[model samples]
Target: MRERTMNLLKLNIVVLIEKYKKVTDVARELQLKQPTVTFHMKSLEEELGVPLFHSRKGRIVLTEAGRALYPYAQKMLSLHNEALRTMEEYKGMGRGTLRVGAEPAVQSLMMPVIADFLKRHPGIRIEVQVEPEQKLKALLMVEEIDAAIIEERAALELPLAFERWNEDEVVLICAADHPWVLLEELDPGQAGQERFVRHAPGSQLDRIGQAWADQHAINLWSPLTAASPEGVCRAVRAGAGVAFFSRKALAGNEANEGGGIRMLKVPGLEDPRLQLGAAYRKEGSPASLINEFVHFLRTCAQI
Candidate 1:
């Protein structure tokens, strides 16, 4: 077999097999003539000295050798893009793209930091993907996203590099006039008996609240559930029930707009804080931008 090069692969095999699956369609997608696309395909097969593609069911499909090379082609393309961006950065162009992933629960916090980062560096482009922690980690692993912001607990469990950048306090909130608001501090026993307005099941707060309940042997009776922090706050303000919410979600005002809601202090609870962290793969993408964005995230947490 002859020496194989990236130029020989050139993503033609990928689009032909995975996307278009036809010479004409691949040609149109690549903005090249059909013959040119066919030439590239044949060249790739000849270089590898293997039948990478065969016609079956009227569609172009990859043979075993071609299927095995698909992932490497994807990585090579991703690395090529990254190398271009890195070169642009080193040239002092001060312009590149950063793809960031975050869990939906922390978007409110993540957006502000993203906005501030763009304001400081207008030339750079940032794409934000909001997904669950597991999805975000998968995207990071595949080089689909440059970095991820997730709960510290979830981030720690992943094999990627993580930095614990912030801590979000979980404060018990109730309607302003609720009787619990009058108490300086509520014990676990008092909290256990109250009807809690819980966050939707599977949410970060919901998990934390459940674990807290189990550790204290408190069987929480949640008669109200909201899918979002804002919804939970609205429910608490309307006197539906009490809930534990992140302080950041409350926007740092315990009074919560005209004193409609109040934050309560709870004692004897093992943990009342939700930790947040930024995670990223150690290689195969731009590191500088990821680090800079994480710095902005930390700065935003301080504010």
Candidate 2:
């Protein structure tokens, strides 16, 4: 039989077991007549030389042999989807669903990029999932997402293709009129004495900030924590305490008179900048799609 015939068998079996249990329902779902579905079901069982399905209490159910083959059917269908998506990439950038993963810290940077991408490629579908650093990497590795925007350092350690996507200036922010504002540069030692608003524990920004502090042997007196960059910015503006934030967090409000946040420079704060990157699995990904998206990312980074 042809490969298409085998695929048909796979599809019918999968839908029967996992989706619609009745042959009529399966036929309706597949847009085939009831007899056609029954024919395929009988054909599959004969080819396997085993009874694959049987009726139980007027409901069609998979037999032991059918259950054993279900996983293989699922895998075949998944591969089929990947194949279709890969082929779609070659036709043109005009169409295809682009699934992207992003860490929370980079979300602000992603919004404009995604918006512009959709406008330029109107037929393309885009799905954005916000996940933690490790989870984002996990999704990329499994091909759940076509690409991700996250810290370059995090992507560096993974087996992925990385392109520096953006420059996220990690700066210390406090109320505009705070005493430290008048100083040429805040002393690292003084940071130990002031009340600090910290990024939530275990976050990428939190970890990087902590590592920098440890490197300089400076201890921050943090009694408050914010879960997001925006939250941290709001807390700092409200005079909760000074906190570290990416320039993205200061969007629309940075250096403006009405925005009560001031970006500060701390002496010995070496390279207080995080490099964000576009990352994707090095193999088994739609290369055309990734390349096209990365091109947009590079363009967006310059603006």
Per lDDT, the best of the predicted structures is 1
State in Å the error of residue 45, model 2: 20
- Rate residue 22 of model 2 by lDDT: 83
Per residue, candidate 2 scores C-alpha lDDT tens digits across 107-179 of 8778888999889889778899977677788888888999988888888888888878778777777888789
RMSD for each model, in Å, please?
12.9, 11.1
Q: Each prediction's TM-score against the native?
A: 0.63, 0.66
- Window of ten residues with lowest summed lDDT in model 1: 8-17
* lDDT for each residue of candidate 1 in 104-177, tens digit (9 for 90 to 100): 56778777778878898887898998775667877888899999887778667678887676778877888889
- What C-alpha lDDT, on a 0 to 100 scale, does residue 280 get in candidate 2? 86
The residue pairs in collision within model 1 are none
Q: Rate the local accuracy (lDDT) of all candidates.
A: 0.77, 0.76
